[model samples]
Target: MGIDELREWQAFDSVNPIGNYRTDLNFAVLAQQIARWSGHCTEIPSLKDLLVIDPLPLTNEQRAIETAKADAARSQAYTQSLIATLQSRVKRK
Candidate 1:
């Protein structure tokens, strides 16, 4: 009964944005529901199906640059997430 009501309510809500969608609802859960309703898909890939092979050789300087780039990218990704978190905090108030 609960799921049926949720589905019916959501059908109307999708057309006209009417409810309070709280942050208590997880993003992953929202994404899954959206994907299902929109007829798209979210896939979890298996490790055996994935293959990454790097055949190119690099010099010492080039290797250092690549390593630095990877580290910088990791830092940048975290910084972006931090900024988004701060922005969301500002929005909620």
Candidate 2:
């Protein structure tokens, strides 16, 4: 979980009743986002704006998954950088 979600959980767990749906959802989403970010999962829309997927490792099937994820992350960074540079040059001209 990110800082935001952790704090929210601590606060709610300490005092609140059993069913605060709003806070629960916010924390859940944050946790999911953090998990996805760590895994370099491209399905997360929020972090897509912030991160690129590094290709997942390919040592074994599991490692390969990680290598592919890392590669994808790097690829995303590369593609985005290329586009940004091209756009900047076009603008300058």
Candidate 3:
């Protein structure tokens, strides 16, 4: 595919090839354009335009998962500290 075809593919703003219906076809089209761009494309699009350097905001589900992981880590640390205190008291007795 050429630059003209690539531009044509990118013309639609709401045409995300991910997280939508028609999974197989969407991925195939996205892959084809990316391969063409990477293989022999001069003057690539900027990072801002691609939204790679500055990523999209996380959804509520993602934020909840991160919070749960952090909570589990803190709980494990507190449990370990309590066990160490109990062992030290037994030794003293």
Please tell me which predicted candidate would have the highest lDDT against the true structure: 2
Rate residue 22 of model 2 by lDDT.
54
Q: Candidate 1, residues 24-66: lDDT per residue as tens digits?
A: 2344455556656776556643322232322366899999999
Clash tally for model 3: 0
Each candidate: RMSD to true structure? 21.1, 15.2, 14.2
Question: Between 1 and 2, whose lDDT is larger?
Answer: 2
- Considering summed lDDT, which 10 consecutive residues are worst modelled in model 3? 46-55
Which parts of model 2 are misplaced by more than 4 Å?
A: 1-59
Work out the TM-score per prediction: 0.40, 0.37, 0.40
Query: Candidates ranked by lDDT, best first?
Result: 2, 3, 1
Error of 3 at 28 (Å): 42
Which ranges in model 3 have alpha carbons more than 4 Å from their true place? Answer: 1-56
Q: Of 1 and 3, which scores higher on lDDT?
A: 3
Please report the TM-score between candidate 2 and the true structure. Answer: 0.37
